[model samples]
Target: MGVDFDWVILGILAAFIAYSLLTKAVDRSLLTLPIIFMGVGYLVSDPLRAAAPPEILSEGKRLLAEFTLVLVLFADASHVRFSQLKQNWQLPGRMLLIGLPLSLIFGTLAVYLISPEGGIAMALLTAALLSPTDAALGQAVVSSPDVPERLSETINVESGLNDGLVLPVVLLGAILASAGVSDANTDGLAIAALIQIVLGPLAGIAVGWSVARLLDLAQTRQLIAESAEGVVFVATAFAAYVFAEVIGGNGFIAAFVGGMVFGNTYRHHIRFIREFMDGAGQLLTMTSFLVFGALLLPDGIEHATASAVIIAVLFLTVVRMAAIWLSLLGTGLKIKEKLFLGWFGPRGLASILFTLIIMDEYVFANADELLACVSMTVAFSILAHGLSSTPLARRIGKT
Candidate 1:
């Protein structure tokens, strides 16, 4: 019914055609799909932006980004084998419990130093926004045939769990960053965080267990539909998120936990679900980037200051690497392995959604600056990590 919709449809179609033509060339080069979509989004945005105005478009972009993440969280947790999680649990455990918090702490300090005038809350908001990593950003790193299985699995699980784990922190920071954030509102936010963290996993376990039992019954009776097979699996993924949100829990965390439980409880059925996601995931991930380039990144660039640009680069390099290195120090990992892990923490969809939540839900004096820093950070991450993914993976694999 509006302008941005038509433009996005055509733009994606055109991008696909161009992608088809350039597929071989891109595969042979350092160019990633995100880089292409983002470039196209920036180019076509001015004329094609929605007639509904700024706020509606921003909300639409946020929802698209959120949906992309929902699918990713569900798929990632479900895909990895239980054996892998049990064996390498310590790496990701230390990562989620120790490394992520350190990154936020160091990132907050760095941002506060960079912009002491922006206040502690603003710095916290910026660091919290930037802390989570995006596995999708470095698809080659996680999904490549050449990469070591344990290494890829480690990154996959770490990224999958971190997005949900970091939500409470981001929500707290956002509330504090709000202009008139009161003690009462802060108390309410803390309560919500507690519900999200605790209930999200519990609800996920309940839903995922239920879904597994239902699917088992269908399979035992040979009642599973051929035409609806994919749809059934897709429903399984969304069911976890919907169920959690309905019960005052965090949908993202539910999606991740539901996938883990669903996958393990019905390991035999995972293949069908993975097939469905493999087909749909690329489309969704690309669409999010396209919308990001056209709708979100431009606004971010408009608001960017020199300070934001510097902080963004610092995040991709110093902030993430230092945290990963410190956390992995006594884990028996080598210096190169540690550096490789550190260098690959690219920020993507999760960061976009977090920033959008701020823009939508709350108003702050330094909101523009916070978003600008996030936007710039993700944009740089796409390029820096995308180009380096293949080359670094090859080097690491050889090691």
Candidate 2:
């Protein structure tokens, strides 16, 4: 059989160049990229053309989203300064303890009231999935050194940590909702969840620390080459993920914790590793946005009901703001700072990943409704928050 190898290679190259060009445009107009790509997907889909295979679109989108989240979780965690985190642990602590749970509770109640077709458990699952904010999605806000270091650090740390912290809740909620609370294997699930949560960090620390020490020794012996350092960095992250998953731990958590431990333990090597992983992670994140546009958006839009739209809006604005307001009450932050921090907690990768995991692992009674709810919420967040992030940060700085 003759293969059209040249045509395939040319097409791949062309697509990459086109995507790179699109990235420049995306930087200029943050709101346009997702909206345009989404429109392209909708226009090109089977509804518009009967010849298009739906599964091709579906599978491609799902895979891109999964990989994107993994890279983002790792990169975000790696950039966190462990020393700074030590000094300001209270911010993240309050966020995980006070803000996150309240967000879930309020989100669940809001979904229940808004989604007439969704049950209580399903509502909670939806809430749990959307509870954690994504710092990567709103880099403008979280990365602004113009903002108070304390505020930025708090949001950054919370965004990095809360995503991992909320994984067990999402898993538990999905299990209870999908398998039926009575029939669910809570004991086994709980044990597995605990192991995944606890072991993920331990595995990351052990692997990252050991590798850092080995690299240090290798450098002392003049055995470590410049190129090999990059390889070691990638290997550390990959090993952390694979080993944790092999033991039924959370790979995302492992990647994050591993990156953190590696960053801390191997501060000298971090410049090399962080740059490579971050570039790789950005590529993955962009691919994710494309897939999200192509696959999730179209289906989510078709399934979107009035209830779904209302819930998405409420979750993005009212529910989240309320939870943040309550969480920051005694923290002594100014009113402007509180509002700025609260409004900027954009939900992105973690929600997308958790939703994908739920779909893969369990069959919810209202799968479509749950998916629709999460998808709409995420889409809104990416757009609404992406557009306002820069301006909002500037405004906060002025105030």
| Per-model TM values vs. the true structure | 0.90, 0.85
Encode model 1's per-residue lDDT on 225-333: one tens digit a residue: 7567667667877888888889988887888888888878873456776676656777777777877788788889999999999999999999899999899878888
> What is the TM-score (0 to 1) of candidate 1?
0.90
Screening candidate 2 with a backbone cut-off below 3 angstroms (N, C-alpha, C), the clashing residue pairs are none
Error of 2 at 364 (Å): 0.9
The per-residue C-alpha lDDT of model 2 at residue 137 equals: 64
| Whole-model alpha-carbon lDDT for candidate 2 | 0.73
**In candidate 1, how many Å is residue 196 off?**
3.7
Question: What is the total number of backbone clashes in candidate 1?
Answer: 0
Best by TM-score: 1
